[model samples]
Target chain A: MSTKTTRTQDILDRTPSSIALYRLLVPFVIVGLWELLSRWIGPRVLPGPVHTFSALYEGIQSGWVIPNTNVTMQAVVISFLIATVIGGVTGLILGFNKPAYDIVEPFFLSFYSVPKITMYPIFLFIFGVGLNTKVGFATFSSFFPMLIITMGAVRSIDDVYINVGKSLQVSRYQMFRHIVLPYILVQLVVALRLTFNSAFLAVILVELFAARSGLGLVLQHAMGTFNSEEILIVVTVLAVIAFVINIIFYGAQQLLEERWNMTSDEQMGI
Target chain B: MSLTGLSSLPYSKQIRLGRATLLVAILATLELVGRAEWFDQLTYVPLSTMVETAYGLLVSGELTDDIITTIGLVFVSFVSATLVALVIGWFLWRHDKVKQVLDPYLIVLYAMPIFVFYPMFIIVFGLNVFPIVLIAFAMSVTIIIISTANGLAKVPDVLIDVGRSMGLSRREQFRHVIFPAAVPYIFTGLKLGFVYAFIGVIASEFILSNSGLGYQISWYYQQFQTADMYAVLLIVITLAVVVNLGLIRIEDRLHRRT
Candidate 1:
């Protein structure tokens, strides 16, 4: 078995470079396909990748992209932070309190599916413009998943460790720091990837509905003017930004798992 | 420990009662606030009033049209997305090199705010149900594809070996062994897919649409008919919660089975 494993590892080690080549080639192939399809589909409706990239370049050079992206990202980040902190605490409480978890979890699960965008008007009325509404809306969008996972993380911690800590007369703080924190932190990172997506989606959505400024507004204008290239540019930039954030969160989760010596929630089937 | 003997009830019964009581308390608080007019009429409509308005709307067949239209759009897009995604995902699982190449793109699509392209969809497909369907499809298909692909990847090699030793064909192997094993994961994807689809479609309507439940709510809001809007939202939310609960139940059942 060891000999077979070593042989397989050797084969795996040799293949990554080739896989990297394919990964790099993917965007080029996609761009090429887009360009070809544009010719047949008509440039007005579906501009080539070259044109879209140039427009994106112009937007960046002229200062439209940066400020808009800043405004949108500010809302997303602020909401995400608020959701994470509050949701984590709430989830910990719920996890340790079974009656509360049982009662609240169903509502959380049900609310997860509701198109929260429908309630934007209520936020608009309550906050009356500025940052709070977007942040609140985004927090609402992202909070449930974080809370759910955190609760599960707390619940899933092995009883053996807790019992050992108690038997050792470890202080509550020490018990948390030594056992609960590491396990929960890893799971928190995993949940953040999801919550981040939700937060960003909510922020952009509100911007789309009615915003004084943001990338969503830019996309809306492009739509209003029927400028396909501009629309594609904003979308591509947004996708790239989201992808970067997602990759960062994923990397962070992996680092935490390795460095903290934590078991990932998935391996426990939670 | 209770003098009234209340604590003698089963633990499960206590939980159910607690859940029901909590739910009622929340609704009752909202109802009380609405009646006392402590909150602005613009923000809080009495739950009773909202229900009454909804009944009137249904009697006039106004809400029925919008509900049917929105649900129809969701069903159509969700079904197409599921079929196409399953095909593409199954093909990718069969082709390792292609899956490797496409994996990052799928991740990006899944993470990105696909709803931002709702306008582009509208432009391409025209301002109609087509755009709505396409937006929902775009929102859902990537996650399904990714989940389906991951599920197939996790199908135990031992199961395949069992099927092979039985002289099962490739199709039979997939049908009897691989598909069943991967079902729980696929259900997870489907639950999220349905969620994204519902969000995408309704949100698209909220942004721009002439017909649908979302349109009705937005229209009322725009017209300053806050009570009417609240009523419609109440109906939509109830429908959403009930349907999603059903999906969650099914998902739990599947998880247990697997």
Candidate 2:
């Protein structure tokens, strides 16, 4: 669940254990360079880590951080949930019917590849309010990735299981429960990781564009005042939040995979 | 589509027809809704009107500079990011210890909100094209690096051995064996890199820049030219879909090769 291990486990774990020392040391090196750079650029424009952290602490103590962060988090969470449910169900249903999947697959791919930024304005007109646009953009952005991943996973369920279920004349519910659901259950968490990341970033993006109150507003205020330390503080806070969310989902994915005795490699027919 | 739908056509043609029909259905509904005055004149824009607005802008040569700027930035950012990523990727591939140290950081970098530094970029580089390019490059480069490293790593051991057995030098082995073997993976990276770079450039323009395709769209919306906004939005959407479909075509070709 640590940041280091949140990447594909095999790739992250393949390095020699001794390399772990470098992993631990790299952050220090980056911080050192950052400090020097900040000094060169002038601390007012680019604050050092020490100053950033101190400002973060002060910002927290001043109590503005909580309300703003709360607003962003609420929007992100709601959008994430909405996207997951609708996208997952749609993916599952379409994924099961090959004909439907083939027709829709191109649509999904187009949606996934098209940057939602271009579509944001249209939504802005349709929704008309900043908050509606924010949540709508986040949800809309997250939906395709969730659907695509879920659909792909569903489509990859081994034919053997379905064949056996067919032979046994299992009910659709039973077949889904004993076969299709099991495979996707593990992948669902993995898909959620992507969806959550997308949702969080999308929310932040809209907040940056037009939000009454959010961490992005905090960031905008800092930029307005040329408060470099506060900008760093908010950036750091966001990074930590994103990092922690990734780790949590990753841990859940690992746990689910172990319980299912199925890694993505197996699901992928690799 | 079901067998009942477009059953007379070949399968691929049937799919195309089905998609066309679906698209027409959706667009027709929108056109009807727009004509019905459903969302007030200020909000909804019909499809035909959007096309007319786009034609008007094109004929008048309006948005020409903005279109050029957006396209130029996308091209520059993608190419630069690709070049930088390939070099870094090679360095990482050759240096196991360095790769180990950078792997997690790479993931973090790819996922982190690079826009957090957008404020600094603007202040440091000023409100020029440089900041936008830098942000787009940052947005795209990490995925390319990771993909390049992955490709190089996946180069089959047998291929390398074959190169060595043929008395090829280390450099020759990389050039002939590793690079060719890694083309598919690298191409995959480039594809994703381009997508990210395009998005990053447009998104940055939308958020800050005073001029560009993204800016024009937002400007139209803000000025209450809802039809003009949709028209420009139509342009952006069409560009996106065309480029994406083109990439997917090439990607499919690459996959077929591999």
Candidate 3:
């Protein structure tokens, strides 16, 4: 059995580079196919890879990447911060008090599915066509997921932790700080990751609907002029930003998990 | 101790009372604020006015037409996306090599705001319902694929072994054990798919379409018809609430079976 396992391990070690190559092969094949299709259908219908890259390169050189990206990120960061503080506090209150949760949970759940963009007009009407409406909408869109997750995280804490705190005669603040906060910290980070994604999406959405600046507005303009390659560039830039956010949050989540000595899934009771 | 003792009271009745009270309080506060003109006239609309406007629109069958269009887009896109996602998810699950190679891209796609592809979609499908439906499909299909494939991956080898040891054939093992295990995850995917599909459709309407609830809201806002905008929003909120509640019910039933 030991010899058999060693043989398999040796084979696995030998194949790591091959696996990496195989991974690259998939994207290579996909791009090749896309390029072929674009050629066949004509660039008017679907721009080839070369055209997409050129547009993306031009977008960067012309400073299109910097300003629009900054606008979207500003909205995301501002809204994320506001939503986190508000949603976190609200969640803590509701989670700590079952009566409050019971009173409010139905409303939260019901409105959870309400697409935030549907309320953009009301926001636009009130705040006008600029950053305030965009940020407000972004905050509103991202708020509920964080609220729900934080509440769930708090509620899912094993009751034994609270009982231990009570038996040790810790003050309520001390109990919450040492026990409850530590327990829910990982989930809170996870919630921030989710909120970040939603916030950016919301920001882009508002920009698409009624913004003078941002990537979404650029995409809208591109669409208006039938600039498919430029549109693709904008989409690619947004995807890269999202990927960076994911990496940053994931790293933070890992750090928090290590410090807190708990995984989010375990805290979630999954 | 007192709190624990109070918990023994009829839980359902207590919960219902709490919800009702909270709803009433919220509505009353909004009405009061609107009546007192707390905010500027341009900023706030009372719930009564919103309802009245909604009723007017309903009687005229305008909002209903938009609702029907939105629902049709959602329904078609959702069904088609689910089918495609299931096939792709199954294929990915079957091919471990492809799964490993593609997982990171899928994760990026999941986080990426695929709605930004509207321009590209419009380029491809033109100015019609197809772009809206495709946007929704693009948003949802990735989620379905991930959930379904992840579910398949998570089926315990021990359970599979049990099936095999019971003299079950490969196909039978998959049918009885693996498929049942994955059903819950598939439902989760479906629920998320519905949400993204709903958002995508509404958002597309706002950006591109001339009809649908989203367009009505935009149109009314453009016209400076605040009451009409709020009325359309009320209908949207109602639809959201009903769909959410319905999904929850279906989820609960599925979870019970598992």
What is each candidate's DockQ, to 2 decimals?
Answer: 0.55, 0.46, 0.52
Q: Which stretches of candidate 3 lie over 4 Å from their true place?
A: A1-34, A170-178, A251-262, A265-270, B1-8, B39-43, B156-162
- DockQ-better candidate, 2 vs 3: 3
- lDDT: worst 10-residue window of model 3 chain B: B1-10
- Which pairs clash in model 2? none
Chain A TM-score for each of the predictions: 0.88, 0.86, 0.83
Stretches > 4 Å off in candidate 2: A1-16, A251-270, B5-9
Error of 3 at A216 (Å): 1.9
lDDT of 2 by residue, B48-78 (tens): 8989999999889898999999999999999
Here the TM-score of candidate 2's chain B is 0.93
lDDT of model 3 at residue B157?
82
Best by the DockQ measure: 1
Q: Tell me what TM-score chain B of candidate 3 gets against the true chain B.
A: 0.90
lDDT of 3 at B124: 84
Q: Lowest-lDDT window of 10 residues in candidate 1 chain A?
A: A1-10
Model 2 C-alpha RMSD to native: 3.4
Give the per-prediction TM-score of chain B: 0.94, 0.93, 0.90
**How many steric clashes between backbone atoms does each model show?**
0, 0, 0
